[model samples]
Target: MTASTAFGQAAATGTAPAFDAARALALAQETFDIEAAAVLGLKARTGAAFARAVEAMLAVTGRVVVMGMGKSGHIGRKVAATLASTGTAAMFVHPAEASHGDLGMIKPADLVLAISNGGESDEITAILPVLKRLGAPLVAMTGNAQSTLARHADIVLDSGVAKEACPLNLAPTASTTAQLALGDALAVALLDARGFRTEDFARSHPGGALGRKLLTHLRDVMRAGGAVPRVGADTPFTELMREMSAKGLGASAVVDGEGRVLGIFTDGDLRRLVEKGRDLRGLTAREVMHPNPRGVIRDDVLAVEAAELMEKHRINSVLVIDDQGRLCGAVSSNDLMRAKVI
Candidate 1:
């Protein structure tokens, strides 16, 4: 095209709709900034009331009953799930459902966490009287401290925000974001206060891959009984290599005549022996075995723990033993990797 024509086309494109992609991104960034600030402001509010909230949940011998309305209800469900998954016994009860006979689910020993932005949700506040009649403690997470929900609660967790990110300041976007973050803060604090163990977390999440990794034990996945690739210490390296190849564990245990593990030999050792010009066909396992290799008791060992042991010893596998030092099982790094626990 001619230069004049090309310039005219560029000018036409520049004026098209007066739109710039960066302007849309700027608006999104502004929204995120507002929400982030709203959450940050909650840090000061978490001082005393946060501790009280944790104390209340800790005092409970039963489940934590969480309730909210509208947007708050969605956030409440997430908080309850997180609390339950992290060792706190918590469940969500719809505020509307509670009015229709579900109130019976709340025991006297349970703790209640109610959520609302304006703190005047009648359905939620209506349950306060019934909750009190049942003698259950109530913790209200709300933006309005003087609102009915806050006034009726046993403890008020202020989740007040300065202003919403919505241009008209009518939407629940920023406020709801703050509330969810605050709820997470509460759940995490309760989790830490209760000293929740990884195993406990795993128990609540047994179906997920993380649970499988943390809850799986060495005994559960290791080759044991007749599956173990082992050979007597006096056995020829040729025989030991055959067993290792057959089992596909890339290693074998060197044990005494009594079948008690005494050492371990691995593929790495074979490579080194070959490099050193040793005759593998004539050598016995006793000549190439790593004496007194690290091991763990099978009755109380996790596969992740075995992986750590392998890492610390710079080895790939370990012979698991019983209290009597007899061979109970064997494990490898690959097993832990397959379980996604290492």
Candidate 2:
């Protein structure tokens, strides 16, 4: 590239005056070290106050009203979300907004979780009395134990850090990291106290992968009724192959007159038989099928469990049975993939 072109590119991107790769790497490592130490420091100072905060939140009949300002506000939002998803009802309310009208979001039965690094964010301090008067319990997470926010709080969690990762030490780096780690610790404790389970977490995150795995049932994703490729024990091998091809399930279940599963035959089985020069034309499904296939599942089974069964048995498809052991449906690895359950 020409000098003018390079200058133009640099000007367009608002490039810095100098680039020092080694210095940048060193500073990056220092930043990680500082932030990691800050979080570790919080672990050391955490005590009964943290337990009291979790107990207060667990006892709350109403949602946790998380209040903070600036960068603390961002951390508050994440904390609120984590709490809500993990069985604790919580929401973030910006301090400045609360001073105007959002204070109504808090109730007497609710709990307030106030976050401020210096413990004296003007927006937070300005409303401490109002929060107190509202009759809601308050838990403060702050770096300064003697600050106004901490002084007014019912429980104080010390998230203090010695220094920030910033070279100038003006930016909210280590302090904010400490606050975030403290918030996560609080959420984890509350969830454990509440007996929150994986299924409960999945309910709050139905759109995510874990939710799909836990919530999706075999019946929800299985090809049922006529969609299932099935044939009788007396069915000719050609007719069974036709059923498999027509349903495109890659396998066919051999059921009795009562619809109970007796055997299963797959394309793989047919291939092996063909390679063995076995005359399939005179064969019946019962004669050629693998009886009591191990990859059989119930309709009530979780889709993830079905995936596990298929993986464990090295099968591409599974036959689904009802409570009476009757063939109800079938599911393939491709079906699971389409449902995003695998």
User: Per-prediction RMSD in angstroms?
Assistant: 6.6, 5.1
Sequence-dependent TM-score of model 2: 0.93
Q: Which candidate is the best by TM-score?
A: 2
Query: How many steric clashes does model 2 contain?
Result: 0
Which regions in candidate 1 have their CA more than 4 angstroms from the true location? 1-20, 126-135, 294-299, 340-342
**True lDDT of residue 305, candidate 2:** 94
- Cα lDDT tens digits for candidate 1, 1-342: 433233346566786435546655665776888899999999887888888889889989998999999989999999999988888899999999999999999999999999999999989877778898999999999999999998888899989999887655677988999999998887788888888888888888888887877788888888788878889988987799898999888888888877787888888888888899977788888988989776544646777788888888787777888777788788778877777777
RMSD of 2: 5.1
Best by lDDT: 2
